[model samples]
Each structure stands twice: as structure tokens, then as C-alpha cells.
Target: MSALLQQRSTGAARDDARLRDRLVFGDETAFIDLYERFSSLVYTIAARVTRDRRAAEDVTQEVFLAVWQRPLAFDPAKGSLRGWVAMMAHRRAVDLVRREEAHRRTTLDGRLHAEPLGHGDPVGDQVSDADAAERLGTALRALPEHLSRAVTLAYLEGRTYREVAVELGVPEGTAKSRLREGLRRLAVALQSIHAQDGEGP
Candidate 1:
């Protein structure tokens, strides 16, 4: 039984590796093959996790789109192709849930429900967004190189820590540590800046 399992695993690895190579070279056929092979499983996992058909479909599309764009990120040596794709789908779906829940919390006023809030001043919102972006950019630039790279990749670019690890060519544990420390330092730096400006962080 162990031999059978190993053989199957090896076969899948070889198949995925070939597909990856084809994808890296911009082969449409390979992209189609990957989508055909794993789209259903990705969709099913996402649908189950998010409990939203549309979100599941969006997640599935994003997963395949990511594979299509960065084929090299999928390293067969790290794990089986099926497992990797499934995990990506799950992470993305969970991210969507977290973001949606956060939004719901912000909009909710305790247990009591009321009319949705107004859009407020669009121009003021844009100015505030711009100011925040400028402040964050300045703060990020002040961070140490390693911390800046880690935080930028993970937070700004929306890459998972594992993906950040791959991008930074560092161990996964190291990437996680750097991200945590970076976030802490960034908060301190921003708060200090806020103090200087006589505003809240």
C-alpha cells in the first residue's frame, strides 16, 4: 500500500512539474490543463468554507489566475500540486470571510440595527486615504530593509507568509518572525509620528 501511494504521488508530481514548466513558458494549453484538473476541487473547498457560491467562484478564479501568473511559485518539492492548490483556495476563501466579517462589524452598532450609514464626504475620504497612504509609505521606508521587505510583500502585496518566504528566499519561520517584528516596529514608528503631528495613531 505504501508503494502504491508513493507511486501515485510521484506520478502527480511529475505531471504537475511538466505543467508548471509549460506554464512558465506561457503555454495556454498547460494553463487550461491545470484549471481542468483542479478547478472543481478548488471551487468545492471554497464554497464549503465561505458558504457563498459567488465568492467560491471568485476564489477559484483567483487561485487559477495566480497559478497562471506565477507558475514558479508552485514548487512540487514543497508539496503535492493538489494540496498546494487546495490550500491556496482555502486561504483565499478565509481571507474573504475575515474581510467581510470585519466590514460587518464596522457597520453594525451593537445588537440594534438601523439604516445603513451615509457615504459621507467622498472628497474628504479620498484626501484622508491619500494622507494615510503617504504616511504609511514614509513609515515603511524608514523600516529596516528586511522588515520593510517582509511587511511590504505580506501586507501591501497580499502575499501569504509562505509566499513571502518564497519571494524573500528565506525560511518560512524566519519570514514569520520578521513580519511580526516588523509590524510591531511599524506601529511604534507610526504612533510616534502621530504624536508629533498631534493626532491619534
Candidate 2:
């Protein structure tokens, strides 16, 4: 790691120690302090993985919430609290990406049913290109916020669903659902867009 990253890692370790102590003693103020201290770091990781500011923010919030809900569960002997939080953030980011990929694949599959084998003529090429772009855009926009977030993180940012789930503080199953649902929605949206563009789907 770079010097800056090293420093950050050290600071995070310290904060983790503090958090563990506070939680063990049932100090709510200490928990809040920990949230304020690490929220930015969590958000940064989430944004890097998910490639969406809003989604990253949501993930950060969820991470802190998990800490609050299960303060006593964090075992100081096993690892630092910071590491645990970071791991969670990473998982969430991965989940977001997987969901997105699933959505994209589903959309493409749907569009394939109506797509011509070849765009041989200039007019055909232009029409086909336009239809393809429209279909893609529609599919992306049709995803629910969570699903869309997963797609943006996984496909756009090149992260895995496991990372996304950790960052989002959701279960792996939830991450998969987001991807699957997003993809299904994308397929429907693509079909709709194609029909609107005068293509028989």
C-alpha cells in the first residue's frame, strides 16, 4: 500500500480497537463516534465498487447500521473492526455488480429474439444500431434502484457480486436476487423499447 493507504490502515486499526472497547462496554456515543470516523472510508470503498454515489452512500449507512445492531458480535481477537467493516463494504459492491451483469444478459437475450441476422444495407445498419442502443438504455433504466446499482458496480466498475454484497451489508442471496430481478426487468424493457421502435419483438 501507498503511504497514505498505510496511514489510513493504521488509523482504521486504532478506530477498530476503540469501537470494540466501546461496544463491549455498551457505549452508544462511542458507536456514533466510530460511525462518523469511518463513514467516509466505507463510502469510498462502496463507490469504488458500485460506481454509484447514491448506492455507495446507502451501503455506508447499512454498514454502520450493522455495527450498531450487532456491536457485541465483533470479536476483537479475530480481527479489527475496521477490517470487518471493509470486508462488508467489499461484499456489497460485488453483489451490486453481479446483479447488473445478470440484468444485462437477460436484456441481450430478449433483444436477440427479434434482432436481424445481419445489417447488410446502410439503412438496415442504422436501424439496427439505433434499436440496439435503445434496447440497452431501456434495459438499464428499467432496473430497480438496487438492481441498477448492482449492474453499475459489477459491469461498469468491474467488481464481483460478493464484494458488492459486503459493501451493501446484504446477504449473498439478496445480491443474486438483485442481479436476477434487474436482468429480468432489463429484458422486458428491451422488448418494450424494440416494439416502440417499430421492431416486431
Candidate 3:
């Protein structure tokens, strides 16, 4: 049974490698095969993480699209294609959650600032969002300088990773790495703050 399991694993790895090669060669059928094999698993993981069917669907599509666009990004020597796809889905879902929370906090802060202060403790209502936004800003500032700059350009300024790389005079991969690390640190900082306030991050 152990030998049979090992054989099956070896066969699966070869299949994954062949599919990856076809994908790298721009074969449409290979893309279809990959999606057919992994899309459900990706969507299930995304839904589990994001807890929104629509967002899960979006993340699923985005993950497959990324695979189609960058097939060589996956290294068969490092891991199985299924595991890599699953990890991407989870990472993207978490990033989506973080972005949504940041936008909500930002929007709440904007509305607080925009609304006229007259009735029903507008000032009191502003306090929570104001504090959250302030904490977010402070957290961003606390990131390493390169990471903070990459994140600011890519996210806050709405620049693409390529644009951020060009603007910062760094390679695109380096820019992406910086932005990812920056967001991760920012998420940790904000989660800590939210936990302190008895809120979910």
C-alpha cells in the first residue's frame, strides 16, 4: 500500500509537470485542464477564508487568470501544483479581507469627516473610525522604509506593481515582495489594534 501510494504521488507529479509545461507553451487546453482540476478547490478555499460567495468567485477567477498569465511562476520542484494553487487562493483571500477592512475604515472616516456635526453625537461616532484610520496610518509609517514606499505606491496611490517598480527604481519582483511584506506587517499591526478594541480583524 505504501509503494502504491508512492507510485500514485509520482504519477501525479509527472502529470502536474506536463500540464505546467503545456501551460507555459500557451496551450488553451492546458489552461482549461488546470481550471477544471483546481477551480473548485480554489473557490472552496477562498469562500472559507473570505466568507463571501461573490468574493470567492472573484478570487477563484483571479487565481486562474494569474495562472494563465504566469505559468512559469510555479516551480514543480518546490511543490505540487495543487498545493501551490491552494496557497495562492488563501493568500489572495486574506489580502482581499485586509483591503476590505481598510476601505471600510477609510470610508467610515471620510463619512465622519463629511457629515455635519449637529445631531445625535456626531463627534462620538467619529471617534472610533478616526482612531482606526489613525492607527492604520501609524502602522504604515512603522513599516520598513522600502516596504512602506512600495505599499503606498501600489495600494494607496493605485499604481500597478510594474509602475511601482519603475517609480521606485526596483525590479518588479522586488516591488511585489516589498508590497506583500508591507501589507503583512500592516495587517499584523492593525489586527493587534483591533484585538485591543475587542474587534475582529
TM-score of each: 0.50, 0.44, 0.50
lDDT leader: 3
Better of 1 and 2 by lDDT: 1
- Which lDDT tens digits does candidate 3 get at residues 158-179? 3568978898899999988988
Per-residue error for 72 in candidate 1, Å, reads 0.5
Q: What TM-score does prediction 1 earn?
A: 0.50
Q: Model 3: which ten-residue window has the lowest total lDDT?
A: 105-114
lDDT of 2 by residue, 2-27 (tens): 56545654665666777777876878
Report the Cα lDDT for residue 153, model 3: 55
Off by over 4 Å in 1: 102-201
Cα-based lDDT at residue 174, candidate 1: 99
After superposing candidate 2 on the true structure, give the runs of residues whose Cα lies further than 4 Å from its correct spot. Answer: 1-15, 102-201
Q: How accurate is candidate 2 locally (lDDT)?
A: 0.62
Kindly report which residue pairs in candidate 3 clash with one another: none
